[model samples]
Target: MPPAPQAYRPATALLDLGPTFWDPVEGANFPGTIVRYRNDRAAAEVGLADLDDAEWVRHFGRFAPLPDTLPQPLALRYHGHQFRSYNPDIGDGRGFTFAQLYDRAGRLMDLGTKGSGQTPYSRFGDGRLTLKGGVREILATEMLEALNVPTSRTLSLIETGEELVRGDEPSPTRSAVLVRLSHGHIRIGTFQRLAYEQDEDGMRALVGYVLRRLYGEESDDPIRLLDHVVRRTATLAARYMAAGFVHGVLNSDNINVTGESFDYGPWRFAPSWDPNFTAAYFDQTGLYAFGRQPEAIHWDVMQLAASLRLVAESEPLIETLQTFASHYQPAIADALLWRLGVVPRGAEPDRALVQTLERALRTTAAPLDRTFFDLFGGTVPASYDAAWDGLRAALADYRPRKPSDHPYWQGEPCAMLIDEVEAIWAPIADSDDWSRLHAKVDAIRQMGEALA
Candidate 1:
């Protein structure tokens, strides 16, 4: 086994950090399926293996001397408009980006905590994450990746020992820290919050800083800074659609300006081929539903553009916004072709193949796996085919009445039948059936490779 991380922060200080999200870690709890990890080993395995003394001290102010390296949410100072209102009170709550490290695959990743503790942004609420929230996030991320959506990965989930109250369901709930690894965690909401507060200079400096850090190619071009961000944001929104994942909470705060999938609360996999699946409990208007995802993305891009408009203009920003649909349509089309059994015959936009696939699915009311595997994925290579076959057989008697039931297939959103795909992902919520589901997942993966 690898050694634990030193209970100290690195001395090397990089970015000028800001306030915290919640007040403190009042409690903690997690599911048994969570993976326990030591960050020190993970860091050392990559080139960014060590932290300077100062770095550790500044980030991990309270939770020092940890058994393993947990990312200290580099307290980012950002403001956001929640539910269409400019709420200048937002930041990382529950937890923050504990650390940034390259993983075993040589991929750059951010170690993020779900309910590590509270920070400055925890205003009035307990900065605690629920047990179900953490579990759902893990399952959501895992399945999204298997479906080819760009997303954050769950690295470790440790129960911190405590409980708290909640208005949604029950009071005195379990608490835990769910650490997620992703490409980055910065968001457009981060910029909007600052700009909304007339922090023009702050927003500009942030834009320049982000370009250098992420979009390194456009760092020097001050005038085109917002333009670059707009393009990147637009591209990501389109891609999110290709994976059939609905980021229910597309609040300015949840929009990852870094292009990485940011927050994971209230997110739901689409139930069927429909794009109107809403994940949030009270999303009566379905602002962030399945059908509105693409449009929601543009609106978010517009918000980011508006934040930049502090230095630019609405018209120019709107012009830049046009690129979203262009990029998205083609990308989704290509993605759908791969998911469906047919290739782009260059005949009729492939709607026939899509319609056929959907019609067939509705006929048998089979699991998404069976529809895609038997039809699009085929029975070859065993894994994907077997997975679908297993899933269909297991859920042979199941039915879907709502849209948030299962992981939706991205291509041709409305062309298939959906009982809310709940049954396909049923195992994730139930530990008893996880083993069977995992085996099926492995098979699904094989089929995914063929599609790729």
Candidate 2:
């Protein structure tokens, strides 16, 4: 049967907050290009599935504001700590929030861009993105979503006919503009900027705006907001660990207020259960390694607490900050159980199970993701091995989330390992063959549905 048409409900709540938070900006003009990809599933959620290719490129590619959306794009102002060093010079240098709208679930979503153009924050660099960068982001978000991590969605990728010079990759690389749909673009760095400026009035206004827009609460007290953000951040960190993802950069600005992980750059899934596993080639100290993500997020939370001091008491803020450790441990267990497709027994038992699994994976140097797939949704060859007896015994108390008759249980587990991702991109880099990338995305979506 054909489904009922979705209703269009575009919104612009963020723009209503006032011009103090952002600067009006224009997107760059690119040479005539074509839409490389479009997330129709996500588009349907936002009542935009009927848009033709021309409309898609006109709005997303050409950066024309959507009907009933924001009148203009906004370059949000923010500051972030880079590598533990305070940097006041950072903002949305290359991208801006193009529009805001409500999805089918009534959640306020931001239509933000990457490589859209230069803004006030574009400091001595071209506001551009490479086609390879857009491709990598698409892969990263897809894999993370399939693994049940709270993340942004890559909505569109349009290949702009421009050559960009980059030091890290092949110079004069093909250019593209990417758009990301997310819960919100407000970051921990957003508050940091307010605090740095000593703008108590601005801080108070931001606190009120965030509470009303994102949290759906009207609270004059900032402590409650801090507590909520800390809990969300801890849960996000736990999800990353369960997914074996290293974010590479744990800067305050990169951490969103909604606790939804976005702005993927140099992200990698760990091949094995190594806490010290790093993703970025430039991360010499491994400060934002796979294992240290929780710590880095906690540090970012403390910074948020510090920023809230302008409106809230430090005593309560500090107390809220202290709960992150307690929140994270149980969150890790729950996340792990979710990935394993099992109902958790309880807090203590779940923690013990997680510890047991981690110990087994580390001691045997097992492939992290493959190990989860091996034990979950039924059993693979690893289940019968004596080495996994502890995990088997632990699983005796839990039940499968999926039915035993599910077809996914009968096949090999799908994975998005580094080697596999590069292999998918290799054909495109060499011969413009995108069939592998499309196939991989389809397989990842299937995995997500099976796990669901």
Task: State which candidate has the highest lDDT.
Answer: 2
Error of 2 at 82 (Å): 0.7
Give the alpha-carbon lDDT of every model: 0.55, 0.88
Can you write out model 1's per-residue Cα lDDT over 176-264, one digit (the tens) per residue?
56766666566777767667677766666676656665554546443466566555555556556555567778877777765567568
Cα lDDT for residue 452, candidate 2: 74
TM-score against native, each model: 0.70, 0.97
The C-alpha stretches of model 2 lying farther than 4 A from their native spots are: 1-5, 378-384
* Candidate achieving the largest TM-score: 2
Give the per-residue lDDT of model 2 (tens digit) for 33-69.
6798899888887888899999999999998889988
